[model samples]
Target: MQVNSEWEVPKYELTEFKPKAHKYCVCIPVINEGEKIQKELKRLSHFASVIDILILDGGSMDGSLNHEFLFSKGVRAILIKKDIGKLSAQLRMGFAYALSEGYEGIITVDGNNKDSVESIPLFIEQLDKGMDFVQGSRYVPGGKEVNTPLIRKIAIKLIHAPYLSIIAGFKYTDTTNGFRAHSRKFLMDSRLKPFRNVFSTYELLAYISAKAPRLGYKVVEIPVAREYPKGKIPTKISPLRGNLLLIKILFGLLFGKYNPRSE
Candidate 1:
């Protein structure tokens, strides 16, 4: 779908579950998140009336996101990615669709049932207050976390958050958290071409983290719970390889590699 003439997005097939019913939407990116996606949607469906729900599927063959289940959960639409890309490509598709559908803002959360679905309203409140970007954090006053891996925690606290905080000139406690919100104005900014093919993996999140606050957009961090289950964590990224690539992306962002050049 063409959000605007300037936008470019990955190829995908769109499936509609219902008509657009709200000004804001929740865009969840998933792949093979069987029960986790189902559980997340069920809990999130409580607020479906207030905000539309969308799924960006990365060609999941896990039989988790069938049309009947999604329709029953009040999903507004689903975009099954047929293109060769990862999380960021799916995001490009989701954001473009949301903007084209005339959504005023977008709230994005992980599909893996780890984040606080209850704190979704808090992000909505920030967006309604004219905030352009909002990052959710489990390290803040009212935020909570359970069963978070120690190494992952250490990397985020020591490396990721601090590096980005310095770049943005704003303290962000949870830089890696995908639980965030973005306004149409911020996403549509000419200086930040978020729809590009460059943001294929873990780059866009890092780019947005630093780029938004540095551009002097209205950015805020809200407290939210991120719980980890005691057993297996549902993550696609392998720890060693994923962390290295993320670090590379962070450094690239620092050097302005992802920044859109002036035409």
Candidate 2:
């Protein structure tokens, strides 16, 4: 299976389920990504030989990713049908679920190919080096954002970056990027719970990163390669609405309104 410049997915030959071979488990939360789920799945499935892989779906309509398929193919899956909120809520749900199931660490990625799944190994390697949280940043060295529109890029630098830095009280080039790794101990640090942003996952990450230094967790970002599709995959959010929700999360953090559950 070779992927070309045109972004074609090669045929995947299924293999057996083997759980005793790996130490970590990865959790991906996706919603209504039928066309691209398999590609992410292929990236995950191939890597599952070295780690446990699980998919938490937010009630996808086409059902392209179901338990029967994942079970037969060795991937664990969980499907939910609560339209409570946005990306952050779904991820909170997924991470909490994966943690309950005894995963050592968690990696969150966009369902789209915007991030290359191959970076997982690098994330884990860094985790072993005494880092608690690892983030993927396009602005970092070796990290490149492909197919990013001019307007979005401008908005990120001009608006989101500054706003997030002040609100989260940390300086990060790409506060909105979803590709990240979190250790089990980091996840169990309940001081960062009670997330408010449901529209986008970045809000939750920013909240956590802001509180990480206080929690004594070492946070770091590494350069990662991103590939964007010619026609961007549809997000479950409109940019305006997503930004509005993000603002709410920002102010929530600013005014001392957020109170996470006790650890």
Candidate 3:
């Protein structure tokens, strides 16, 4: 499907390995993830028949996204971003493309293999139960957290989750987790206006976290496991810079800076 320019998505190249096979899809935003993404995709392959899989790549210079490997693993498509922007931009491409192709709901997961892909069925069950927004939470009762960095753990539990919960009028124990599901009804709501160019980075995620509850969407958080490798944190973000960015996005939410513009 040709993306309408008015949708505000970045220019992208998409390759479909097969026709759409499910009512939902898992849109993974990735770039230069090397073996991590391949391993994740392999794990996700077990659920291929249950939901479609697509990659929203930020131009991987690394030779990780081989088409044949993806096809062998049951990935249905890949959307490579050809324009500037970061994770949010790739996600914009993912959401817009999935919706255009008639996916009833979209599930987003980080492509780095930190999340447990096995718990995907739980999210689908919630979506089936009329949840407009489903956030995966490692801090919740049935959730598991393993080998997390002390600083990142503190930041998520102490700062990010608390701040977002207050503004969202909902207690969110795992606000930073990207393993979430969104219904078509929630995404199509005009009041959110998520496709704007302003959401180039972390803005869209934070904005949606706050706006979903305020707009009366049926929101819920389910337990899921997240584990980091025992040796080093696999991230491009420096600790100080990443926290600063999070603080900035949080402030924007505090002031309603990302609200939909009036027509």
Q: Candidates ranked by TM-score, best first?
A: 3, 1, 2
* Model 2 alpha-carbon drift over 4 Å, by segment: 1-21, 72-74, 81-83, 167-169, 194-202, 231-233, 261-263
- Among all windows of 10 consecutive residues in model 1, the one with the lowest summed lDDT is 1-10
Local accuracy by lDDT, each model = 0.91, 0.66, 0.92
Q: How well is each residue in 153-217 modelled by candidate 3, as lDDT tens digits?
A: 89999999999999999999999899999998899788888888889988888888898899999
Which of candidates 1 and 2 is the stronger one according to lDDT? 1
What TM-score fits each model?
0.97, 0.81, 0.97
Candidate 3: give the clashing pairs: none
Candidate 2's residue-wise lDDT over 124-198, tens digit each? Answer: 887788677888888888888888766567767887777766655556777778888888788666466533343
Number of backbone clashes in candidate 1: 0
- Candidate order (lDDT): 3, 1, 2
In angstroms, how far off is 93's CA in candidate 2? 2.1
Candidate 3: TM-score? Answer: 0.97
- Provide the lowest-lDDT 10-residue window in model 3: 1-10
